[model samples]
Target: MRTQSHLRIGDQPWVKWSLITLALTLVFLLLLVPLIAIFVQAFSGGVSSYWQNLTDRYTLHAIGLTLFVAALTVPINLVFGVFLAWLVTRFEFPGRKLLITLIDIPFAVSPVVAGLLYLLLYGANGWIGSRLMDQDVQLMFAWPGILMVTVFVTCPFVARELIPLMQQQGREEEEAGVTLGASGWQLFRRVTLPNIQWALLYGVVLTNARAVGEFGAVSVVSGNIRGETNTLPLHVELLYQDYNTVGAFTSASLLAGIALLTLFVKSFVEWRQARQRAALSEDEA
Candidate 1:
């Protein structure tokens, strides 16, 4: 069973340390160092000042808005992601591969491009927006636009995670459930859901993280109309522009903390998925 890599890359421990140190240096300097620098700048104001900046109502509202967008976006993407995963995996239809590939349009498409798509579709002169304008409806410059595009950008997260997982699990268990007179809902809730729960959840977590952190396109579409349209990322930019570095950094720290919390959550999800995959193999055997 023992395969390769028992020997050092060059059969030298010292060389290995040098390589490791170099790799760490590259990672730390490029990524970690800058991140730490932001924290250093943020906290340089001391705890009391940072706390006050964090407690500011405007900053709090921005955080709330970010959470609100994530709240709406994550679930929508969760539903869409799972449905698309199931659709592609469970059935064949016209243009199936094309549609599945289109799901990833968000990845190839810039967030800015996604926003612009919405903007063009919903803007006063744009197709949908022009039609909706007869009713005086606004989507491009409001929370609706923000949420939809976030969902669009992150929609593939869950489905992409689940498809491979569901594919690997194969359809036999679900088919078995169906064969045993289980209803569609019952089979899904009992058999299908349980099997893919971890992958689904992992996707949701990733979706949430990206939703909370989204900018660029959200910026273009949101109109940044002060308290009404501002999200945390936009709010940070606003503060930075206005020379409120302390407040901006305070907000940045909150986002940073959220990112860290998500990492742990995502790690646990991966662990759960791994465990489930193992259990599934045992059951099949």
Candidate 2:
């Protein structure tokens, strides 16, 4: 006989306002304030000083090396991710689940541990490393080592992003295309690619971000040889340790800019994906 209940958790006016206020405060303190502080410290010495710090030879080298690592990491992971996702989702093979689980190893393992493992296996003293050294090859404490660790750390992003999307998108259309005499490449290029383009782009953006910002693993392997092997994050740490506060912040600002740009692209990709879903829903109706 009682009227239907309309109350919900946090529906009270004061509770709602208080929660909103708390979230805004936390965001300001944790995120916005730090970003603002970075810019402020970066330009504290004036624009000319900031520009000079950024244009220093080491800084430029760090920027170039970071970009180079990301450039190589993205394409390698992209192809591997697509192939892995396609294999697991499209085929019923033995050990598929185990393979998927293994893909998450990077996420579960510490970056420092990963770097150390690579160093042990590929450094000059370990079994493989000793053999490589016999052949006059070196990987640890160099750019190659940096590239290897960065790749290891970022390899799972694209695959993780694509697996769920491809799973939801069943292979019916692909099978239909095959029945219609479509070649494998034709089905993938015409059907699979279009369906997962947004997810793929989103994954690429994430991979690029991580590749650029990685510090722990890269540090363990890079040897921090200033202009030779130092990346932007390592450069920032070196500057701060050497008491070059302004220079440190200047290097940091570049990383902040990259992060902001990545965020913007990620949001845009998400919006496009949502709109695509809406359009698809309308068509089905």
Candidate 3:
């Protein structure tokens, strides 16, 4: 029995690992069940019919418009997220707390309300909308208006990702650069940019995902015009309404595929960044 106990101890496989495996298995089942169902439906239309339906003019137009909007909105959000993160992190201000709270408002606000707020601010009969209309500026229910609402709802992502890191690092590196006679641009380009680039990229990926998949807010402001303001998510809704469940699920599956691709890309990027940081640290030592 003592020899048997010793053998068991020596060859112990592991228990925690089993728990982890079980956890992952459960998670995968939870996600994969619905996804596999959708995939089954998407292809059940047969490869030819699936391709033909997916390539239909309206479907093509919807995909193109959504991609165009995401392309436009993602970059804007990236820049804004980075700049806002830098300002809030690097500077001290009286209303800094208030500013941070305000940035988080979008995260908590119901997306529909966010949509309505934009409408009220930019609609023809609304306050700011009325003034802008008077000045011959158009907004509400326009493409530009749709993108604006998307940005507002997705604004907090990058800033939230960055602030804690900045707080932890403080201003030591940047201050050191300044003390070494580094110019403002040099300090930012050399010191700041390198530090936060990963978080920025990750935020961009997430923000792009959010913007592309956005429904409630975009639905309200977009007017859901086909071949015009109809983004992919809205298009899915339109197809679903027409009793085109296959088409709708096809589009949803496409979005899900994009989301999965983005996540893998983000993970790869973060992995590379981590490896590079590790290499640099090793070299410095």
Task: Highest lDDT: give the candidate number.
Answer: 2
Superposed on all Cα atoms, model 3 deviates from the true structure by an RMSD in Å of 4.0
Model 2 off-target regions past 4 Å? 1-6, 283-285
Give a tens-digit lDDT track for model 2, residues 1-285: 433377677877798999999999999999999999999999999999999999999999999999999999999999999998999999998999999999999999999999999988998888799899999887888888999999999999999989998897789999999999999899999999999999999999999999999999998889889888999999999999999999999999999999999999999999998887788778778
Of the two candidates 2 and 3, the one with more favorable lDDT, higher being better, is 2
User: What local lDDT does model 3 show for residue 272?
Assistant: 68
C-alpha RMSD (angstroms) for model 2 = 1.8
CA shift of 230, model 1, Å: 0.5
All candidates' lDDT scores? 0.88, 0.93, 0.84
Worst 10 residues of 2 by lDDT: 1-10
Q: Sorted on TM-score, highest at the top, how do the candidates line up?
A: 2, 1, 3
Q: Put down candidate 3 lDDT per residue, 150-239, tens digits, no spaces.
A: 888888988887777667557888999999999988998999888877877878888889988999999999887788888889988898
Measured by TM-score, the strongest candidate is 2
Give RMSD to native, each candidate: 2.6, 1.8, 4.0
lDDT (0-100) at residue 100 of candidate 3?
84
TM-score, one value per model: 0.93, 0.96, 0.85
- For candidate 1, write residues 1-285 as lDDT tens digits: 434556646557688889889999999999898778778878888999999988788887788889999998887888888899999998889999998898888889989988988899889999889999999888888898888888888888999998898878788888899889999899989998988889999999999999999998899899988778899999988999999998888888888889989999999988988888788789879
